[model samples]
Target: MSTPVDTPAPATTGAAPAALDVLHRVFGYDAFRGQQAAIIDQVVQGGDALVLMPTGGGKSLCYQVPALVRSGIGVVVSPLIALMQDQVDALAANGVRAEFLNSTQGPDERRRVEQAVLAGQVDMLYLAPERLKLESTRALLDRATVSLFAIDEAHCVAQWGHDFRPDYLELSVLHERWPTIPRIALTATATPQTHREISARLGLDDAAHFVADFDRPNIQYRIEPKAAALQQLLKFIRTEHAGDAGIVYCLSRNSVERTAAALADQGIAALPYHAGLDAGIRARNQSRFLREDGIVMVATIAFGMGIDKPDVRFVAHLDLPKSVEGYYQETGRAGRDGLPSTAWLAYGLNDVVQQRRMIDQSDGDAAHRRQLSAHLDAMLALCETIECRRVRLLAYFGQEFAPGGRESTACGNCDTCIAPPEAWDGTVPAQKLLSTIVRLEREHRQRYGAGHLVDILVGKRSPRVAELGHDALSTFGIGADLGEQEWRAVVRQLLAQGFVAVAGDGYGTLVLSPTSADVLGGRTSVRMRREPIRASRPARATRRAAAQPDMPTEAVPLFEALRVWRSTQAKERSVPAYVVFSDATLRGIAATRPDSIEQLAEVSGVGAAKLETYGELVLEVVAAAA
Candidate 1:
């Protein structure tokens, strides 16, 4: 039986006219994105809200502007200390009275912040959920007047979310403690079910719910099946975006270190960032990535939540993310400045097995595991799909893309659009593979991994296949028409489409999913791509020419000068220059020839510290060049 869906109630009230004036005065913007104005208005009017906006969709302003305009302090509950510090730093740089209470602070410092809160001096106080459990913290919260309680990363409250925390489950007590205070729960990534879980867990029964579209129009999405993934990653980085600020995400800490080292060896300025690194080093590396340009931060998923860097040109995944929501959030870190960016991912059958094994090992409830598996299946389908990757991605998030419309462009700059491959009929091969699975009694027995199965079918008398006597089976040698690479591709596509599953044991054997019966029953047809031969390397001159931008001849020298200056500054500071000023920022400065510290400060990366440190030297260089 289908369960009835509950309808959302209308917002409790409207925002005050005074708040609108404050928003313009502080934020320097006239309006909000999507439902931001309405959400902010509701929050300002002392009504609870649950906001689910995509990354780079102005989730912060929904709470920030209201917190500034509202009467009392806005208490923001965040999960990560680094994220809280980043947000607080950015807000303080904008002249907002923001502070954070987390493990980083001493008791005396915490007491000072509490005193400031009690004195109504802080407009916003960011707290880690763990900090809320302290006796002193609860006592302060009991007495202090809070205009609104904001939960950032609200999806963490849901068990089905990729980054769930148990402390978030206790947040519902906020409503019981401070019944009159308005609560605003905000997250950049959450599915429809996750949204419901968050709303329920936060005790936001009468909250105004706002779900902005999850599609990131500026990001070009591409998925490549795993074969020489590292080489492909290097080619993409070197050929398309030689020196752009980007991130490379891995599924493991070891992979992060290895990939970072490999990129550095190839003359790329890369750094490893994971929980294993010391806190100081991680902070420095993160700051360098945020402040510098053209730095490739190879990190696990720990690196990019709440990162406000706007011009990250690319995001590459060395492994598949846990779910589509996680993938979207991680990829959304790029192209945030409304500029062109790329989201490239590489996956294989091994990734599927490992991910499935992870799900089986997790201690989540059955419903949560089922939901996660469904989400992962959707992600795998996206990876294997020959259709527009952006369309499938949006559909997973319950959003629709325009058919054959400009909105479907996906930047007109993805691998599939640029160089789509021809498809071949694979009905017979698929049937053989499915039949093999059943013939081996592999349905519940020891399922074979793709390599072993392909070896058996293609008549490669490997030691393992010989031992199993699978060469004597009727399905054996029937797939000889397909090469090893081609068979591997088919197996990957099948696994991705949920037509098969992988065993949770060490052997990582592949078993059939429920959908396999349809294929065996001749109810489905498969069309697969033939593996393309690797192309010769481009000529050196041609590669350099491709890397060069088509700037005006007069501007070229200035750009070079800026780059040289940036290189020197970066070397002296032991940081990447994009950390000093992005290429876009450099272009802006070179074009405008900002004459003073005040003018240079207006540049994106020329924050107060940078301006104070390098202002004079930059001005001298600019004046000399002019």
Candidate 2:
């Protein structure tokens, strides 16, 4: 027997609301930020666009608003099934007729949504790319009139990207099939090369590219040397971000499990998420992290993409990421609501060796291997840079990082600017290393990795040195004054400065570059930042103060009451608490302490439907707290 699916009445049926009207009455915002209004206007006017907005920048509104304004259903192509469900659930909470089709749906449930879509009862239809790849699904889309096509996480179309999906390659058919419908592709992170690749692969070359400022000023970047990684991570969480929702990224499944268990043993609410976990456990853990306050999730990179939880207070990395793009996207998950957040990372020299080894050992042709190596080199340079981490990170994506002049203004948020590291003249050492590499290639006709070169420089008498007769080289004992660690730092700096290059194959051998001539001939002076000694005490995550909510002390009880009410509502509905009311909105309700529904309607996130649904209850909580 088939159960009848009740279709909720539309909020307003006759005329499409203006963009501002939709923003306020639907999504509960006073105005559009950044280029959101312009992007919405463009898409509503039936133009194609490629939107590169930072996470928590309201990328959803770009399509959601237009879907309400334009006739027919807006088709959003999402990649993950869980993400699709979450999105549709959130939309439904906001009184939007949103539905999703994915493998998680049984045949009857899927047919119900399909019937609704064809009947024009759904405003937005979310589908995984793999779903659209099915001929039956494509035929279904053809039968229904779609208002527009939105490709979220469009970077997945790039074959070289970290999160590539082969199904995304077939998305070009959207343009071919619905040639008249507007299309907008969006992603939180993309470098210049990736930007171009996404534009080309998605058949969005002709679309207007709206690249917002890649700078996430709310997130403070801090990187430290890995020493007692677990204890350091614990001290950081306990001291700085206690009782806040945060994520800890690990390099392996084992590390994730161990870290989670250790945090749990320490009385922290921690859970592990990795591909190795059973699907039910992974789903449950993810659900708890999204719904519960102050739960820490220890996970690999598989955990964060498309997660809509906006209150994540911090994202910490216990291991080095594969590339800058991966790091940027992962860290961007935090501070989505524009509150102060932390991006803390712990890395060591061994991370470099392991990352290089992985790249070299991977199955790929020379060109492919070279591409991967270039990506890693950029990331390594970021890790080792003494300049502002934000500046270097944004520069990787071709954005000039000049927030202010050095003498007058600057982004005082990053660790480097807050605690400046001293730079020392490395001209003499640079000359010696360059000379060593040249001699190794010219005299000995040999190229060696950093470890071998450092060994020879520091006068180590290894069997390989004796076999190669490398000790006979003049530059061998010249570098003996500097310890092996110091020499390693110098080589890494040289690689970063382009004075030296990593040779072919997995050995990571150093080779002289054309720029090395300038350093060797004393035509250019090299200045390298001295690596800070590993801290014996726990390092402070950031000098910045912890995030403080904007509310009066007297209203604190009211805020708690509202949270309790929201939790109850979310639990009753079997959805994440934020879907009932975000923390920011609850705070606003508390601070304002509205006495009536009309007054509560003025809150930033309170829309007509939400005001109608939860308005009276919110006021009741506020009044009761009195």
Best by the lDDT measure: 2
Q: Please give the CA lDDT of all the candidate structures.
A: 0.77, 0.83
**What's the distance in Å from true for residue 545, model 1?**
14
Against the true structure, candidate 2 reaches a TM-score of 0.86
Model 1 scores a C-alpha lDDT of 0.77
Summarize candidate 2's per-residue lDDT along 472-577 as a digit string, tens digits: 9998878888998788777767766667765546667777777988888889999887866433323333332134447767777888888889989988888888
- Model 2 poorest ten-residue lDDT run: 1-10
> What does the lDDT read for residue 188 in candidate 2?
87
Q: After TM-score superposition, what is the CA distance of residue 424 in candidate 1 from its true location, in Å? A: 4.4
Tens-digit lDDT track of model 1 for 265-364:
9999999999999999998888778656689999999888877777788999999988888999999999776666789898877888788888877787
Question: In candidate 1, which residue ranges exceed 4 Å CA deviation?
Answer: 1-25, 403-413, 421-424, 438-447, 466-469, 513-517, 527-626
